[model samples]
Target: MATTNNIDNKRYQGLIISIALFLSLIGALLAFTFYTSSLLERNTALIDQTNQVANSAQAVIKDLFDLESSYGEDISSPHIQRVLTRLEENTALITNSLSAIEQGGVITDNLGNRYQLPNISNDARLDVAEAKEQWNVLEPKIQTYLKDANNIMVSSADELAQAVDQAKTSSLFINESLDKLTRDVFSNAERQATTIRLIQVLGVAAIFAYFLIFVFFFVRRLRETDAEALAARRETQEIMQTVNTGLFLLDKDLKIGQQHSRALNKIVGEENLAGENFTNVLRGRISDKDLNTTKQFIEQLYNPRVKEKLVDSLNPLTKVLLHNTSGTGSDSRFLDFKFSRVYEDKDIARILVNVNDVSDAVYLEQRLEKERSQNDMQIEMLTTILNVKPKVIHEFISNTKAHIEKMNNILKNPGSSQYELEAKLKAIYRDMHSLKGDASALKLHSFTKIASDAEDKLSALQNQGALSGNDFLQLAVHLDDLLSLSNTIEMLGERINQTSAASTKAAHTTPTATAAGVRAAGAIDSTPQANSQVIGSLDFDEGEDIDLDDESDSHLLAYYQDFAQDIASRQGKEVQLNSATLEQVQIPERLKKTVKEISIQLVRNAIVHGIEPPTDRRSAGKPSTGNISLEMQSVGQDFIVSLQDDGQGIDYDSIRQKLVELGRFSLEEAEQLDRNQLLKQLFSSGFSTKDEADEDGGRGVGLDIIKTQVKESNGKLNVNSELGEMTRFVITLPKAS
Candidate 1:
């Protein structure tokens, strides 16, 4: 692997170097070409200027000849003046041109363009000097003749002849000198042209030679690189075929690279995965939310600033549950996808995805976890059963069985209409909540969790604006699980009971022990009747008949106390259950079960919601232990059951917030509701101020359960509270006839 990586690195470096060198060569060639072209332009411009100067010098000599010829034709002052004027103009033009040529100065052309000329070569300069000296000798004579012509035109004939002779002599020498200078200038320009041609040919030859050399080495290196790459590709293919992991590269666009491991096809359960959008590949296999998150995750991978290991925690693809699209493999699998950034220098290039089919390992882990959970539940159930009285466990088992049956019946009678379906959901929710309360009260966490999970499903169904029979399909599974759990608990309870009974029988098998055993069993049998007489003596309405006042009623009261304490402990609060008044009142037979269920739910509510924690209680200038008073008394033909807690009272503000959160009322509407109006929302189904539901009172169903039972018994329920002070619930049920 290291060797392959090194080779890859070397190839990348080589590619970079080659590109840089090619660009440099192009730049250098462009610069050299521009420089040579500029030099040629300057040379051409100099040659043109030199030709213009030479033409001006020749014009000077022709003007002199014309002056001399003019004197020969006419000795008139006007003709002489015309000749002199022509001669003077030509002379000035030649002097300026020669001076400019010799001394590197500006020379104006016919079109008024001024060009700065450089000094000519030594040979050309010498020729220019000689021409200037010859012109000087003729210049003074011409000036003298022009002055003499202005004074006396006819007497100047002799002087004009002399001037013509002087002009002829000067013109010969000057022309000779001018010819030499022109030749020298032309020669220099020709030499420069030759040098330019030579330089261009040499430069082009050098460039071509360099290009050939560059191509030779470049091709050689390229062939070697191709060979190395081919070897690496074969090695990579071997590894790809042999390795179990699914490997591929994902570009910034989230497209898979063309080269991918053979295992990727099997792991993703697809062929031709290359060049496909990664999101599309995972589209139907995973959830839309995970797919979107995966896109964002890969995007983050492309960002060089985000550290690979740091963002790894946010990877949504880890341990993804993918349903196989192909019909060949298992119906589903668990694939673990790991991503790492592929870097080019300091920049992120692509993401390397490593996929492993972790189905077997995951399935094994899940099986172990399931077994471990079962073992834990068994241990917890045993601990609970051993700690609790046999009668209590029996009562729990019976209640759970009945609740499960009620749920099953509700499912079986899933109504066709939306309202009826919603009603069915509520009914199941109430039963599940009741079951959860019972399980929690008995510390049967496994059953509580099952019940909670069922409630969660029901809650989801309930939240839907529309309902269908298909929505209830999932509920059947929860019901089945609950029923199975109840059976298991019942069997375990029976086994424990048999074991206890056998132990007792064994302990009392001796002859003397036999008589004591008989007496003990009789006392156990008559204990309910004995307690009934004791309850019958309590002050009550005249015709109030107490139910089977088994020690079960006392156990029921004790259960309430213990249940309150357990809930308080779980919520990190201190609570004292005051049921002295409740103990004295004889609950009528018909209302006994209804009253018990209502009391359990209400007690749980008070502990979970109304009651303040120990710290809050102390801060409220109250005792650390919160007070929960339960009282039942006969009033006229009715029995009034009052449960009050000296803790944080019903928070109307919290209720208003919950109302807004649940979308039952807008924020403005919730704020506008009075205390009396808010109280009505408290009894509404699926309404609670709590953010999240737990096994305890957060589901908001507890108060609804209370209201439901009260309505069923044709009882009146009232609630009153002072915020931060106390909250009370009053239930008034007519005495059973």
Candidate 2:
């Protein structure tokens, strides 16, 4: 690995160097090209300037010649004056053009931008001065001739001819000097062009040499690296194919390696497992919670601060049971997972995971453990049977069966209307609480465990104050489990009785109570006193009646009132519940369960969320005790149940803000929602004003479940609230079929 890493580092460094060199060469070539192009433009511009100056000089000479030719002709004085004016304009143009060539000034460019041109060479400057001197000497002579020509009557035509001859001679000298200046500019432009071309060629040659050197080195390194990589790949392939255990590598991002063992796919129940996130692959196999924990565990393994051994206990994938989806659901397999860090030069390179299927061994171990537990339980049961009175065992079983019946009745016959959820909750809590206490008194360990679990669920519901119809429905599963165990114990008791009857009948023993007790005590030899203590706890003489099917005659409204009073006393507050007669309203048995669930939830919500304590009421100048009222009646085909409490009403503004906070609506949308729309949010799941979950309120589910039950029964839930006044929920349900 070290050797491979060194080779890789060297190759990477070489690649970087090659790229830098190539970029440098290209940069140099570009700089040279821009410089050469600039030089070429300047040289061309200078040559053109020289030519323009020469043309201007020739224009002056041509005008002088025309003036000289017109002097000899019988031209009028006006025509002579015009010729002289043309001659002077041409002379001035030549002088200005020459001065511009000597001293740089603004010239219009192709883009109509003014750009300054540089001064010409010294030789061109000297030529311009000579031409200017010659023009000065000839200008006065021409003007004097023009004066003579205008006075054709006083002056002879010879003076005009003499002036023209002098002007022509000066023009010739200026033209000769301009011509020499133009040749010098052209010769210099040619030399500069040659130099620019030569520099460009040299630059290209240097770039080519640099590129060739890089290519030769890069190719040699690439070939060497490829050969080494090919050999390593072949070796890795052989190992991957032969390995029995599921082996795979994970990179820094926890992505599976491209070259993983074939067994890895089978273990994880996926094909083409490579390149996929390891967590995602396991998602279908393990629970999301476990998958997250597994990811954390793997991450911890990679943490430099944490020791691998220290995090071994945190490994969530260790001995995880995975259900084989590829087969029948019954096929569950346990996988033993192991992780190791693959290091390159003392740094973590990748993580290696090894999965070994331990399904058979785990299954065997579990079977042995279960058999041992069963053997011990059976022995304990026999000992308890021999020690305790037969009546007590029968009584315990009977009591448990009665409790189970009560639970089923609670589910089947829900008390109160759907709007009085609190009443139903109180009733359910009483039932489950009674069952737990009775089971504990009897010391039925297995029965108590199941019963205790059920009681705990009821307590959770009470604490959360978020009761739903489905919440009660969920209890049926635990009830069934408890009933199943009850039936098992009943069967066991029957078998014990038969065995006792057979032994007694065979011996024909007339056993006295005292002797029977003595024999029972002797069976629990080590704790004879404890055995007597267990039997002595129950009164055998006074037979306890067990009525499994008994239904209470309590009115729903009265029960809620009593329940509210009881809760008020517990809370150290005073509250009164007033209600209209619900007896006349016939609630269908089909809707009873839903109605019961909703009623319990709503009543609890009222006392916990809507009703204020006595002190708060007194401070508000109301009565010391608060009042909660429930009214239910049948109207046409609908049954309407309404409940109200004189307490702090719903905070519409708070609800609106909450809606925005929860992302259910934007701030603008929430603000636009009227009182009616905002009140509907109270029935939304997970919506509540309470900060903490308690038996009375919070847990946000009460109103939600009430609404759901009402809707399921083809009913409608409506809310009305005035801040600092009263809050009411009126539910209207269609009469059940």
Best by TM-score: 1
Cα lDDT, all candidates: 0.78, 0.68
Q: Runs in model 1 with CA error above 4 Å?
A: 1-86, 100-130, 143-160, 180-218, 249-259, 269-308, 323-332, 341-351, 414-419, 460-470, 497-552, 578-592, 629-684, 687-692, 710-737
Query: How do the residues 541-655 of candidate 1 rate in per-residue lDDT, one tens digit apiece?
Result: 2333324245335555677888998998878988889877655566776776678788888899889888887877888889999889988777888988889998889888989
Instruction: Give the per-residue lDDT digits (tens) of candidate 2, residues 462-491.
Output: 657555677788788888877776676666
Task: Using lDDT, give the best candidate's number.
Answer: 1
lDDT of 1 at 17: 81
User: TM-score for each prediction?
Assistant: 0.75, 0.49
Instruction: List all candidate RMSDs to the true structure.
Output: 8.0, 15.3
